[model samples]
Target: MPQRERKLRGHFSTPPLLVEQVLDACGYTPDKDLSGIRVLDPACGSGNFLAAASRRLLSYGKQVGLSARTLARYTHHNIWGFDPDPIACMLAELQMHATFNSCYPRSQALHRLHIHQADGLAFPWQQCKHVDLFLANPPYLAAKNNDLSGYRSTHLRGQVDSYLLFLNMALQVVRPGGWIGLVLPDPVLARSNATQERQRLLAETTIHHIWHLADVFAAYVGAVVIIAQKTPPHTHHQINWRRERWIDAVPAQAADKVSLPLQMVTTVSQDLLSQQPGAELRYLLSTIKGTIIERLQRQLHMQGNSQTPRTLACLGEYVLIRRGEELGKESALLKSSAPQPNELKWYPVLRGGIDIHPYAIPTASCWIAREQIVKPLDRYLAPKILLVKSAGRLQATLDTQGHVVLQTLYMLQLSANPTSQPETQALFSAEDELYFLMALLNSRILQDYLYALHTAYKWVQPQIEQHVLAQLPVPAQAAYTEKEQIIDRAKLLMHACSKSSSVVELKAQSYELYEEQERAICALYEIALQQRRVPDPPHDVVDEGVSLYG
Candidate 1:
């Protein structure tokens, strides 16, 4: 199929190992009797799942002493597959036919096949028998107004996707207390916009296992295997979360037949996830430090002698944080950094990337004409903070040079906190206030808090949006004298960072200065860094069995 057409149809094939792994998770192994288990694949594109399941059914059917005729009849009614592509449906039917024939020869009965070429999203599922298990790798596509004509679904709400609709359909089709094993993208775990889907999943079903397979589909997305049961809410439900990684002694040159290497990292109570924001399933959050980070984020600092505890003042109330203007097609109107004769006036553009670092702005390497420059022109000229949107740590610098920053950087213009008590905030001058805030933004505590709240995967690109940064907390629990000391030190540190220094000496000096302010900041918020204890292996784990350490 053409790439565009394939994308429109959302046809990403599941690997053979992945197909068998999903089946094993669903209890469709050869050793188990899958006689009464009616398995289904809604969007069965080449019948990878249907064929594998059929083979398992035949293996267990004969082991339980069933004749070929009875097994064929049972397969006709139990194994089901559906697809919108006719060619794909034919391929699935052929695979299933061959699977049944390979187990029981001369049993190629055409009437026993139930695979259909139809859109699973709009299929008439009520006419079919009860589905005991739903096993599928559904298509993933973001839902837009023009994406599907007259497409309306209950699951389609704020910022929805096509995969969510398919998952919801499976929940409704499968019988109560049935099993649902699916290969889906990892965004369902912590996407802020997907709160409703996460809530519905937790409210309705009991999640047994979630395998985070990062980068499993390089061309597609980071995938996850969710093994859940269609059962109502119950107390004391625990989810075994695992991570996929290469084994220690395994060589990278190994053959392709080796399935995903699995490691049971940790297991946590469902209640804990349900209580968090977006109820995110951050599988790596298995320590006291993670808990402490959560507490620090929710801590309410005192303000103006108010007896009732309240949230600290946010950065948004005092700063205008906006993304850098896009260059668009106006790049053709620019000039060199040295300034061309008689050309439009050129101003240095703060090109984003590895240039702008903590307390050090990149020297302008390129210039753009004022006509090409976005207005209000003073927005770029003002002494502002240029913060680059990065993953591992915070990167920001004071832009005193009035350089126009390009896209991928956020310009933070500081203003006095409107809600602050005059007696409390009047201690610092305007310049001092800017420096103090800059120090905090580039501080270690804020970085850790942001990562803990958003992700555990440092390598993964995070959603560090303007609104999220605007919500950065500012604790105002200090006397005027203490605030002055902090502001003075922050100014000196930023000034020190602005000068040239060797990489080694700069790192050492910056760490020492940052630690000083970090201590003050932590003291202000009453937070301390909690260490992550190393886990010891349990002795009770059997051979090849995953250990449980919750």
Candidate 2:
């Protein structure tokens, strides 16, 4: 019979700065606050944080005039740790002993620590119900082994991700009004749709700090540490409450002192929105859509079957694809099933999806083209923005081509105005329409909004059908012209960048020519494309987590 192997888990040491910052935020100082600080490390692993906390508390106790023996006893009893790995629990205990002995060399009880081998997420909460501070880098394990209930569901419930589940469990173990600090992937904060519990957990607590540590994890994935204090309001209690705000981390400032009232913490991206109240421009566009849609309906009724301009594309439209569906031995072409002919002048050939972060174009043969094509304005069809609705974490790449290669994705084609309708001319300049369309896709605000909505609704396996696409709020073109110009210039910059044979050779030139506006867009897309979760804190300070920590 084969021997059983231990479960593989992501267990690593917490960075030293993280430990100090978390402790400081919780008012647990080595000498000032450690004597009575009741701390727990839920996913203790090798007790990296536990060992560090023990050292700090021991030092604090000694400085506060506690005897060496008393300090040892307090260190063993005051701090608690739990881990699912028996070996890890033993290792953590050993580490505590080593750190404890260093503080109290003559003490005998220092060798026995309170670290235990048990699933942190599964431990009976009554065991550590009074835990004042919960600080941990929990073992990230997919809830497996028929052990998915208990604390996992109690905290996470509908959340499919284990990291999120662990976060909830950690919060549950911490006493009310106590502090909880944790390191987790960036998405939980920004991804539009976090499980209800995640949003509720954040909304419930007073977040103190958030730190965006670029390339901190070996996964080289961006990470943030959230320090929170649980202080929810009672139904009838007269308590002043506010939503959480994000802060950027600055090295010089003390981590414990970071707090801003929730009312003042509106998302910076909201300010970037194109629609400002009382802007005449939006009213004009609103009037135009109403006029155009109404005019087109009448014209379509009159024209009957004639091919009046039925396609309405947002300006700056990038690629139009000729779709051909081919299985194994079938023709390798995605032939369009639309009533428009292969020679349809309105819909041009576009090939999308080949690393167009900042900029992209279709491969030579990949461009969808009918045999007959001539002149830019002759074709009336416009390419629609269609994203590959997949569950994968990879940054959704640009499908410069109009056709979607991925299965189950939606194809968006603009609804054309009837040839008789004069409103089409007033909607936007032809070139401007395409430009506007591309700008919307490239906008970070729109992307984030889409991402949030996607996350919130992704679990439903939403069919990205026409109704869904239609529901997407369209920003006013005139309101976003400045942003559009930046995107257009970036697109041009990227087009120029494609001239280079390699990224290495062109990187410096790319930076030198790129302005701040373009660079911001590039940085955001690159970060988003790589699935980095670091929240954009507009201020110079780094946010360790949600700013609800007290």
Candidate 3:
């Protein structure tokens, strides 16, 4: 299929080995009885799961002394599949025929297989009930791009993927005791957009296992395989979550070896997941790290204020925040080499995240013509803070040169009305306030808080949102003596960082100073950090072998 069509339809074929894994997860063992077992693949692309399931049932039938004709009849009647593509349905039917011939040769009876071309989401549920297993890799379309009006409900809203809707529909059609094994995108479990659906899934089903598969498909999209049962919500049940690294290429032979190295991250209880507002199953954090981080947040919430500790003034309250302007296709404005004349029109431009750091920018390689600069040109000439919008940590630096910055950076300037109270102006000058804010923004405590709240993976590329930045707690009317000391220390730290020889040395020196400042800030905020062991970094394993089934 063409790439464009595949994207529009969200059609990606499952590898045979992965199909076998899903079947195994659904409890389709060859030793078990094959009679009266009904399997349905809602989005059965080319019938991979159906083909695998049919072989398993036939193998079980042979073990139980069933004749070839009877086994073929049972296979045709028991297994059900649905796909929107007629060609895929035909291909799936062909696969089933091949499976029947391989398992039960010389069976003259024509098998009436239940594979049809139709939208699984719109399939009439009244026609089928008591399904034993529902296995699928449903279409992956965003809600806005596709016609999902039939599937839309309160639980499914706001850019929810089509696979999630398929999962929900499967739950409704499957019997109470039946199982659902699906391969879905990872965001379904973690993204805030899927909060309602996640909550519904947790409340309705008992999740047996979840495996995070990194780069499992040809497109290298992050995915997860969830094996869950349609059971009444059981708060005490523990869900197993594991991470696996699969080899990139499928094995050539059925007997070939494939490495599926697995790591047990943590098992979470349904009660805890249900209690969370989003019901976010964030298993990325290890047991010790999660516990300690939660404790710190709770302490900050309880002890930081007498009445409402959760409420804190955002950074925006004290500064004007604006994103850098994008210089579109105006090649004349930017020069590869220095201008021949050092005119006022040529100003240094900071164009990327690499040029930004904690307290200083290391380099400015490009210069822009000031005449072509976007609106608010005065912002480029003011003493302000520059923050890299797309960095894992808060990459903020003091830009005193009035350098023009590209869209990758955000500019922060002190608000025009610095203080509403005239008496408070004497306590801290604007420069002193900028230094203090820089110190807090670059602190390890604030970094930890942002990471815990916004990221799901250890090595996340977090984009600092304006609203999130504004929530930083500011000291309310501090003593002049302590405020002056903090400002002095911040100034020294900034100077030392700018003078450092290399990035590594600058980070080390900056961290040492940040820790010292954090202690004083913690005292002012009345927050305490508990001593705990930091968890080991997550393991990244690579294994080269043949497929598990092969």
Select the stronger candidate by TM-score from 2 and 3.
Answer: 3
Candidate lDDT (C-alpha), each: 0.68, 0.47, 0.68
Q: Which candidate, 1 or 3, has the higher TM-score?
A: 1
Question: Cα deviation in Å at residue 211, candidate 1?
Answer: 2.4
Displacement of the residue 116 alpha carbon in candidate 3, Å: 2.3
Question: What TM-score would candidate 3 get against the native?
Answer: 0.77
In terms of TM-score, which candidate is strongest? 1
- Candidate 3: Cα lDDT at 520: 78
Worst 10 residues of 3 by lDDT: 541-550
- Which 10-residue span in candidate 2 carries the lowest summed lDDT? 277-286
Clashes of each: 0, 53, 7
TM-score of each: 0.81, 0.56, 0.77
Q: Is candidate 2 or candidate 3 better by lDDT?
A: 3
lDDT of 2 by residue, 14-85 (tens): 655556666766667764766777888878877778877887787677777888778777877788888777
